[model samples]
Target: MDATTLNSQAERFLAELHRSPQTVRAYRADLRHLTDWLRETGHGLEREALEAYFTVHPHWASATRSRKQTTLERFCRWALQHHLLDRDPTLHLEHPRLPPPHPRGLRREDIERIFAVIPPEQTRDALLFRLVFETGLRIGEALGVHVEDLDLTRGDEHLTVLGKGSRKRTVLLDDPRLVSALRRYLRTLGYTHGPLFQATKNGRGGPLRYQSVQERWQGYAGRADMACTLHQLRHSHATELVNGGVSLATIRKRLGHQHIQTTLRYAEVSDSTADAELRRWRRQRH
Candidate 1:
């Protein structure tokens, strides 16, 4: 079947998976890109057709192509499961061997500058941003978090987040401040279930829009006289872990990175930090 006519089947694929609303919405958007490509090229969901679509925009950054590739690959896998195709076209597909963008994690004081201006009353903003920074979660992942996803059970405090490819992984609420902030935020939530961060515009509660979150973040950065993106918070978290000598394997799982190479970008530490690590390693070896 042509991807151009995937609305119904795509909806089915999305519905069968237990993903957050934001994830579902993001997946749907990616599917539409595929649908448009099929309409223009009049090709079915074949391997060559998908490859052509991916290369159509060579100027597109590797990250953008990777996201689309992931979305299409998942759809193809679903189609195979339901007998839509005789073979999985995306089964042996390989991602382009382009180096991922160098991670731009911020320093502690640089991050603190942004946080210093978050008004005291914006407790929700504080908790939400802090969670992403501490946990290295994609902004969408953080926004998708529901109240029920949290497990603050005594010493085992953690968050069960739905990661990429609809995979569920446990995110430990390892930061005492984060756990404390979470509890404080929960107490102020007034409701027992639903999104952890609800949109409060016009005295209404609903799924917070991603755009709204970014806009609010920009405002905070402006007040602090710094130019920062919301995603930099995640980058900063990864950088901190790398500087602290955390293993790449652990960082990969913590950041939900698909490849260790992606985590390696965060390993670009300052000269002093790298020297310190080498010094400690040599002393231990001696």
Candidate 2:
């Protein structure tokens, strides 16, 4: 088949893959790389050309190689099914191996220090950070929050969050202090309905752009001398829950993660607990 035909086939296959938009974009990017490499080598959309390209390429790191391989594999699978190729060229391609390591989580004191650095004049910024840290919300999810999402009534104390893939989940706001703070902020803005955290002075709430939020966070991090992103606040909340003895499954559900493995990364065992476990193992060996 021609190169244009092959590229078209790849796009159709990707559409059929039912992957997320982000995944589809990455696959398209990877395929473009392959096409570019082929053009440089004066090779067409044949199996021999693909093999020649891989033979000269240096070994890539685990993550990078895996992503490239995945893109090719998907393309090959689609090609084979459609009779474009008799066999898959990427079937024998090797992906780099990686070692498992625990995810980095912030200490409770570090979290406090982050909060302490927020300037008093930037009440909105402070509340944004606190809400994300306390709720374990993804930046997009937090930005998507509406004023009606927060319920501050005596018995009902929780926020309804719309997470990735349009999934809705209710996360508890058990801290009365946080609730009070949120209420006070809301009162100041006079936001009774519509988007909760909006970009406005008259309180006619409109969507708060993510870039503005990120820029504000960077400034806060700079002043505090802390290495933090909006995501770190989410990590802080998840780590706190895991260390406080909350179940992995519960955390996963609360965080609206489709897989349990995503939640497992957030688990942070205390150093003392790790030491005790090591001693117990040593005693057993003895």
Between which residue pairs do clashes occur in model 1? none
Give the per-residue lDDT digits (tens) of candidate 1, residues 194-270: 89999887999999999999999999999898888988899889888888878889999998988987888776687
Q: What local lDDT score does residue 121 receive in model 2, on the 0 to 100 scale?
A: 79
Query: What's the C-alpha lDDT at position 38 in model 1?
Result: 87
Candidate 2 stretches with Cα past 4 Å from truth are 1-103, 201-205, 275-286
lDDT of 1: 0.86
lDDT of 2 by residue, 126-235 (tens): 88788888888898888888888887877688989988888889998877777888888988876477777788657455688899899988887787798887887888
Report the poorest 10 consecutive residues by lDDT, candidate 1. Answer: 96-105
Question: For each candidate, what is the lDDT?
Answer: 0.86, 0.80
